[model samples]
Target: MKVKPLKDNILVKMIENEETSPNGIILTGAARGESNLAEVIETPEIFGEDQEILLRGETVMVTPHCGTEVKVDGETYRMVSYHDILAVFEK
Candidate 1:
């Protein structure tokens, strides 16, 4: 990826929604309805000094329509506001 998100913006790659669980439960993308869990690709250039709420390569639940979708080298990515990030998950 050659693009950088400025200020408090974060660049992320969408993670595929689970299709099935180990317990034989079927999980569909529609189950999420209006949110997407994505992996952060790049952290914002500015972190206000020692802020650690977000980091590169972290999986986080983000608002579905918070940012603009960008295409880079045939891959799709979203640049979202740092405040729009709802939750972080262990990779």
Candidate 2:
């Protein structure tokens, strides 16, 4: 099926996480008790440093915890209301 995001909704392609560091640093998945940072690979033209995310990776970070999740080209993303969106970054 074909789907299109509504106003303020964006489609993003998720980048797979790296299993090892470029310097050959081996990193293994942590246990449940271990805290890991969420890895998000975004395009420079989409979102930049110091700018609030209005829409990204097809998902919108609305109110820090509220937003709709979406998918594009078999990749997961998100959607958000315009008010929930902060800004759209483009280079």
Candidate 3:
């Protein structure tokens, strides 16, 4: 099952960070740092407006509560708009 986002929408797969801190303190789900970071999955061939700086396979930090979550082929993913993408991370 492949996904292709429309307009400025982007498909992202959440990247969960470790549950423990550097100091060895185990963090609970509520205590975990907010991880808006995710890997870009797919985007439209051409954007409706300005060309988006994001591309498939890139990791990005998105705005919290900016996207809709979905389950595809038993895998969880989020569909976020271009404006919701706050920052792109280098591999």
Each candidate: RMSD to true structure? 2.9, 8.3, 1.4
Candidate 3 residue lDDT tens string, 1-91: 8888888889999888779998999998878866889999888788866666577899899998779998999999999999898888887
TM-scores for every candidate against the unseen true structure:
0.74, 0.36, 0.89
lDDT of 1: 0.81
lDDT of each: 0.81, 0.41, 0.86
In the range 1-91, model 1's lDDT, one tens digit per residue, is 5887888788898887667677878877676354488999988666776456577888899876778889999999888888888899975
Lowest summed lDDT window (length 10), candidate 3: 47-56
Q: In model 3, how large is the Cα lDDT of residue 36?
A: 86
Better of 1 and 3 by TM-score: 3
Best by TM-score: 3
At residue 63, candidate 3 shows an lDDT of 90
Which parts of model 2 have CA positions greater than 4 angstroms off?
30-67, 71-75, 80-91
Across residues 1-91, which tens digit of lDDT does each residue of candidate 2 receive?
A: 4555554443333233466767877667742222211222232333335544433334322345434556556666544344554433343
